[model samples]
Target: MLTGKQKRFLRAEAHHLNPIFQVGKGGVNDALIKHIKEAIEVRELMKIRILDNCEEDKHEVAEALAKGARAELVQLIGLTVVLYKESRDNKRIELPKSK
Candidate 1:
C-alpha cells in the first residue's frame, strides 16, 4: 500500500511518461498480467492506457491490472492508469517513507 504523498509523488514521476501498454477490446488477461509483472519489476513505475473501444470500465480494468500484476494502483486519470511496484533487481524509484 502507498501513502497519499507517495501516490502524489509517483503521479508526478509518471506524468511525462507515455503509456507503455494499452488495454484494448481484449481487456485484462493472464498474458497481459504476466507481461505487466515483468515490466513493472524492471521499470517500477508505468502507465497503461485504456482504449475507448475497451469493453471493461476504466476503474475495473485498473483494479484488475493492479491485482493481477500485484502492483500498486498509483493513479487512474482519464483513460490512463499509473502503476508502481518496487523492483527486485533493477530498482530505481525511491518512494517517500510512510509515517
Candidate 2:
C-alpha cells in the first residue's frame, strides 16, 4: 500500500519510462504474474500498457495484475499502469521514513 505522497513520487519516477510489459488479448496469466513479480523485484517500478485490442477494461487489468503480483498500483493513466513492490532481498528505492 502506498500513501499519496509515495504514489506521487513513484508516478513521477515512472513518467518517462516506456512500458516494460503489455497485457494483450490473453490478459494477465499466472505465468505472466510470476515474470512480472520478478521484474518488479529487480526494477522496483515499471510501466505496463494495456493493448488496444484488449476487451477487458484497464482498471480490471490493473487490479488483476496488482492482486496477482501482490504489488501496489501506483497510477493508471490512459492505457498505462505503474506497479511497485519492495524487494526483501534486492531492495532498491529507499522510501522516506514515515513517522
Candidate 3:
C-alpha cells in the first residue's frame, strides 16, 4: 500500500506523462495484465487511457489493471489512470516518506 503523500508525489511526477497503453472495447485481459506487469517492473510509473469504446466501468478497469499488475493506482482522472510500482531492477522515482 502507498501512503497518501507517496501517491500525491507520484501523481505530480506522472502529470506530464502520456498514456502508454489503452483499454478499448476488448476491456482488461490477461495479455494486457501481463504486459502491464512486465512494463511496470521497469518503468515504475505509467498511465493508461480508457477509451470511450470500452464497455467496463472505468473504476473497475482501473482496479483490475492495478491488481493484475500488482501496482498502486495513484489516480484516475477523466479517462486516464495513473499506476505506480517499485521497480525491482531499475528503481527510480523516490517517493516521499510516509508518516
Candidate 4:
C-alpha cells in the first residue's frame, strides 16, 4: 500500500508519461492482464488510457487493470489511469518514505 505522499509523488512522476496501453470496447481480459503484468514488471510506473469507445466505466477499468497487474493505482484523471508497482528485477522508481 502507498501513503498519501507516496501517491502524490508517483502522480507527479507520471505526469509527463504517455499512456502505453489502451482499454477499448473489449474491456479487460486475460491477455491484457498478462501483458500489463509483464510491462509493469519493467516500467514500475505506467499509464493506461480508457478510450471513448470503451463500454465499462473508467473507474472500473482502472481498478481492473491495477488489480490484474497487481500494481498501485496512483491516479485516474480524464481518460488516463496511472499505475505503479515495485519491480522485482527491473526496479526504477524510488517512492517517498512513509512517515
Candidate 5:
C-alpha cells in the first residue's frame, strides 16, 4: 500500500505522461487488465484514457481498472486515470517507511 507521500510523488511523476492505454467500447475486460498489468510492470506508473464513448463514469472505470490490475489509483483527471504498481521483478518507485 502507498503512503500519502508515495501517492503524492506518483501523482506528480504521472502528471505529464500521456495515456498509454485507452478504455474503448468494450470497457475494462480481461484484455484490458492484462495490458494494464504489463504496462504497470514496465513503467511503474501509467495513464489510461477512458474514450469519449465510454458509458461508465470516469472514476468508476478507474476503480475497476485499478482493481482488475491490482494497481493503485493515484489520480483521475477528466477522462484519464493514473495508476501505479510496483513490479515484483522490475521493481521501481519504492515506498517510504511509515512512521
Candidate 6:
C-alpha cells in the first residue's frame, strides 16, 4: 500500500505523461493485463485512458487494471488512471517514506 505522500508524488510525476494504453468497450482482459505487466516492469509508472465506449465504470476499470498488473493505483482523474509498481530489473521511481 502507498502512503498519501507517495501517491501525491506519483501523481505529480505522472502529470505530464500521456496515456500509454486505452481501455475500450471490451474491458479488461488477460492480454491487456499481460501487456500492462510487461510495460510497468520497465516504466514503473504508467497511465491508462478509459474510453467513452468502455462499458465498465471508470473506478472498476482502474481497480481491475491495477490489480491485474500488480501495480499501485495512484490516481483516477477524469478518464485517466495512473499506476505505479517498483521495477525489479529497471527500478526508476523512488517513493517517499511513509511516516
Encode model 3's per-residue lDDT on 51-90: one tens digit a residue. Answer: 9999999999999999999899999999999999999899
Arrange candidates by lDDT, highest first: which order?
A: 6, 1, 3, 4, 2, 5
TM per candidate comes to: 0.97, 0.93, 0.97, 0.97, 0.90, 0.98
Find the 10 residues in a row with the least total lDDT in model 1.
Answer: 90-99
Give the poorly placed runs of model 2, Cα more than 4 Å off: none
How high is the lDDT of residue 42 in model 4? 91
Which regions of candidate 3 deviate over 4 angstroms? Answer: none
Give the 10-residue window scoring lowest on summed lDDT in candidate 4: 90-99
Q: lDDT tens string, model 1, 1-99?
A: 899999999999999999989999999999999999999999999999999999999999999999999999999999999999999999899999988
lDDT of 6 by residue, 18-98 (tens): 999999999999999999999999999999999999999999999999999999999999999999999999988898889
Question: Higher TM-score: candidate 5 or 6?
Answer: 6
User: What lDDT, from 0 to 1, does candidate 6 have?
Assistant: 0.96
Clashing pairs in 4: none
lDDT, candidate 5, 1-99, per-residue tens: 778988888888888888989998888889889988987998989999999999888888999999999988988889989999888888867766777
State each model's C-alpha RMSD to the native.
0.6, 1.1, 0.6, 0.6, 1.3, 0.6
Model 6: CA > 4 A from native: none
Between candidates 2 and 5, name the one with more favorable TM-score: 2
Please give the lDDT score at residue 36 for candidate 4. Answer: 92
Q: Which TM-score value belongs to model 2?
A: 0.93
Instruction: Give the CA lDDT, 0 to 100, for residue 6 in model 4.
Output: 96
Q: Name model 1 segments beyond 4 Å from true.
A: none
lDDT by residue (1-99, candidate 4, tens digit) is 999999999999999999999999999999999999999999999999999999999999999999999999999999999999999999788988898
Note the Cα lDDT for every prediction shown. Answer: 0.95, 0.89, 0.95, 0.94, 0.88, 0.96
Give me the displacement of residue 58 in model 1, in angstroms. Answer: 0.7
Q: Which 10 residues in a row give candidate 5 its minimum summed lDDT?
A: 90-99
